[model samples]
Target: DKGELKGAGFSFQVSDAQKYGQAIGHIGKLTSGSLKVGDAVQADVDQARRQRIRLNHSATHLMHAALRQVLGTHVAQKGSLVNDKALRFDFSHFEAMKPEEIRAVEDLVNAQIRRNLPIETNIMDIDAARESGAMALFGEKYDDRVRVLSMGDFSTELCGGTHASRT
Candidate 1:
């Protein structure tokens, strides 16, 4: 997904011996500079790379649901990141998962994938989504309007990321 170098991450109070500027500017916005605000920035992503990432991203969601079902309802995703090579997921748990539990989660996910459940995306009120028992990431802030992704009746979550059309 790497594209043009649209902006730089700069810190004015760096520990280095010298300072480049007195103020820091945000991407697509002017913090304190002569540059005009709302500068148009365009980025092009490699389609093949994007496809791989999307596959991994969608898998991450299924894995989360599988973990919750295998481990316990207390399972909550702490963090996650997916790339072409791997999908890393962190969740809340007191102890390491047993081998059998891990295998069960894997089998469950494989079965779901084989079923080819259609992935549904919809925009709805955050409160309504919550009322329907859709799992929301703990401690994450959400606005009144949110995107909900449902992988059939297996998993439904409030997500804004891109996902595959089917499992």
Candidate 2:
């Protein structure tokens, strides 16, 4: 991916480095952070990192709830990785959904901002969830038990994430 970014730079507005060598500067200056692509380094994640992780985790719940309301009950949280930056949600659907469907999902998600639903998370048995009609993803591997997160009746899913007090 770094190479891909570098290649794009060669064809874009910043094509010639020598042309503006005096006026502009090195290409690295245009980028963010001091960590280059191949640097042998790692960033330590402390308690501050955990708080950021929690915010991202909670936002994911909001988004998941929104998608199900807009899409369908069939929609399930396929997988997720949340951090300070943003939420990446994957769902269960055989084929790629239409643009209208994607937009509707996004719109419904934003609309939740108006409803202030509180997030409630609890650990329970997977069999109990299935008995209660709690939806699970298509190919999710699970143990005998799982965590249930309920954001009003607006969203109820089996998730393991930091929840918001809104519930």
Worst 10 residues of 2 by lDDT: 1-10
lDDT tens digits, residues 1-167, model 1? 42232324321221112123655332332233232347553343455766887888999889999999999999999999787688999999889999999999999999999999999988999999998778899889998988999999899999977788899
Q: List the residue pairs that clash in candidate 1.
A: none
Cα lDDT over the full model 2: 0.62
Superposition error at 37 for model 2 (Å): 36
| Residue 142, candidate 1: C-alpha displacement in angstroms | 0.3
TM-score of each: 0.76, 0.58
What C-alpha lDDT values do all the predictions have?
0.77, 0.62
Worst lDDT run of 10 residues, candidate 1, spans 10-19
Clashes of each: 0, 3
Q: lDDT, candidate 1, residue 56?
A: 89
Pick by lDDT: which candidate is best?
Answer: 1
Which stretches of model 2 miss by more than 4 angstroms? 1-48, 94-99
